[model samples]
Target: MAQKAPWKTNRRKLDITPLLVTNHCPDNIWPGISTQSGTGPGQNGFQLKPGETKNQTVSEDWQGRVWGRTNCSFNHDGTASASGQGKACLSGDCNGALNCRVGGDVPVSLAEFTLDAGDGHTYYDISLVDGYNVPMAIVLQPLENITLDDIPPNLTNPSCQGTDGLLAPQGYNPYPEYPDFLRTNTSYPLPFDQDVDENKISRWCPWDLQQTPPEKPGDGVYPYPDDNIQRPQFNPCYSACAKNNQPQDCCTGKYNSPSACKPSEYSKNVKSVCPDAYSFAFDDQTSTFIIPSGAGFEVVFCPGARSTTILSTSRAEMLQLSQQGKVDKQATIGLKRASASKLRRNAASTTFRLDRTLLTVTVVLTVVASVHVFC
Candidate 1:
């Protein structure tokens, strides 16, 4: 029997199928401040502008929305599948529930392709749904030569380099001319315009007023008893008594007693100032690609929050071997002869005619076989 041709010996084509699954949740949603009468300036009561003080009167509320997409493809077979989902918060804390909300009917798609040897390629595609009942649009575009390795990990670093080092520590309080007592040591400067002369005069006071006096004149209508009288009334001429006063009450005899300024201390509650913003880190370990061999493949886990259409083309391929009956050793010889004949016929076809050497050999052998049969 003639040797079996390599091309007809059940040769297989290289196959590659990529499965892409993606899930996304709202990182931050710009819920334009609630337009309710009492809501603050920005969306949901959060202010967008800097230096704007938030008064207790204004309230804020936020509602979040999510969207997402997935794609799968088989390059060798030219087949593809795509799906998408989207959702919005029904109620509750926007941030906490944005990820938990279930997605609505997602659109799905499939496509197949075939080629005519080398003349041209044929392709068929179908759109599963128009918008999949989702608010956002989902689009899928065909991609060429895209592989699983081509996808890159989500970048976590900020794009721009910081120039904070170049900035000088807020130069000595912009109002250095004002005494230290007049300026608050904070990013926010007191709104009051400081009058240096006025502050200097205000700093000096009759300390004795802060002390308890021996007695108070008796008055039947007085709110308190004379024995409860605080230090003697401010006396401008009693310089000797003022100078000899205790350290706590420096009775200068010049100005009225200084009342303790409302005690100002740092707030322990971090959430008080930035109620909406938070310090957190996120870990995105999602696989950009998947392999599907037996079980069905799903490209998207979190349907809401991501685009319905993937930014790039994706594919999934599956291969199934058939098991009809056990092979017989004697059938091998007949199979070889049948395969060689098929190869010879194939070589003569227009598709394989471009290989001049192969075509010439096939033709010569065919002619020799015919002549030998006749003899």
Candidate 2:
């Protein structure tokens, strides 16, 4: 038997469409794009500040993902700064490069896209398959003179926010003995039942699997003032595969087939939290969404649940503001938060809530307010 060669990049010319990426988080973020197939936007990534937007063009038949990197510090040339050493962001660091050529590190919230996959349509999804770091959403631009009569309701716009924006608030630890599952031939039994409490399923990345952030000031890492919280300090939540690497957790060896591999307790919990987002590798049926081709996309980071007004606005209007140098002004004026009651209205009773102390920390962090060019 001959060995199969690796898939090579195809550099042929491709039709392009506009892509607008915005940062709605109070803090700064570095968005990363890694193309798996077809032509990319040209560069792989760049930095996006709060309330700011970047305009780029992506190939029509592109297959790739977009994710935000948090708590990063880089030199002017885009290399990792001294404080970051060889790594930049605490979550989705890509060898400390401003432009990433590969997918980000685990615990990244990804918006995956496959444009023009079939019948002049695009298939997309928000994936927590690699774990999650931030909230994200994708809205398609309305096509001129074309009605989307055939698009599915779920495909109109896929978003993961509200409780999904949080990272492991429950702090559920499946492993009584840390790193026990990492041993060869050892398997960590699934901790929760399929119908387990919504709050019991951790992201599968207990405190042991969290990525440590640089403690140095100006490194962009945000630490909670009170150390009393039981959750992990850093944001990035590593997947079970990342932490254990066992065949069962990684879907390797005999577990490579879909039948052999199933959702772990961690992924099950994630699915309950964000049904529209991918919880595991084989979570395609419910997680994926489809829309027609010829539509542009708007990817927003930290798109809070209270910001429905901004989200409801058309992509064209937002892009026009970005081009006209009025995005910042509009964001400052039209992006005000709704009432606190309204914000918490849809929250599940079992969902983790930040206490007054954490709320104060968040307020202080917001006061300290502060990327990828694919074209």
Q: Estimate each model's TM-score.
A: 0.13, 0.63
Write down the RMSD of all candidates, one decimal each: 39.3, 15.5
Instruction: Summarize candidate 1's per-residue lDDT along 219-323 as a digit string, tens digits.
Output: 434445333333222111111123244333232243323342111111001011111111011100111111111111112211211111111111111000011
The all-Cα superposition gives candidate 1 an RMSD in Å to the true structure of: 39.3
Best by lDDT: 2
TM-score of 2: 0.63
Q: Model 2 — which ten-residue stretch has the worst lDDT? A: 181-190
Where in model 1 is the C-alpha error above 4 Å?
A: 1-14, 24-128, 133-375
Q: Candidate 2: where is the Cα deviation over 4 Å?
A: 1-16, 145-155, 162-208, 212-229, 232-234, 306-375
lDDT of residue 141 for candidate 1: 16
Number of backbone clashes in candidate 1: 22
What local lDDT score does residue 304 receive in model 2, on the 0 to 100 scale? Answer: 37
Highest TM-score against the true fold, candidate = 2
lDDT of 2 by residue, 280-369 (tens): 777775566544455567787765331122212233323332233122434423322221222233233335544321121121233221
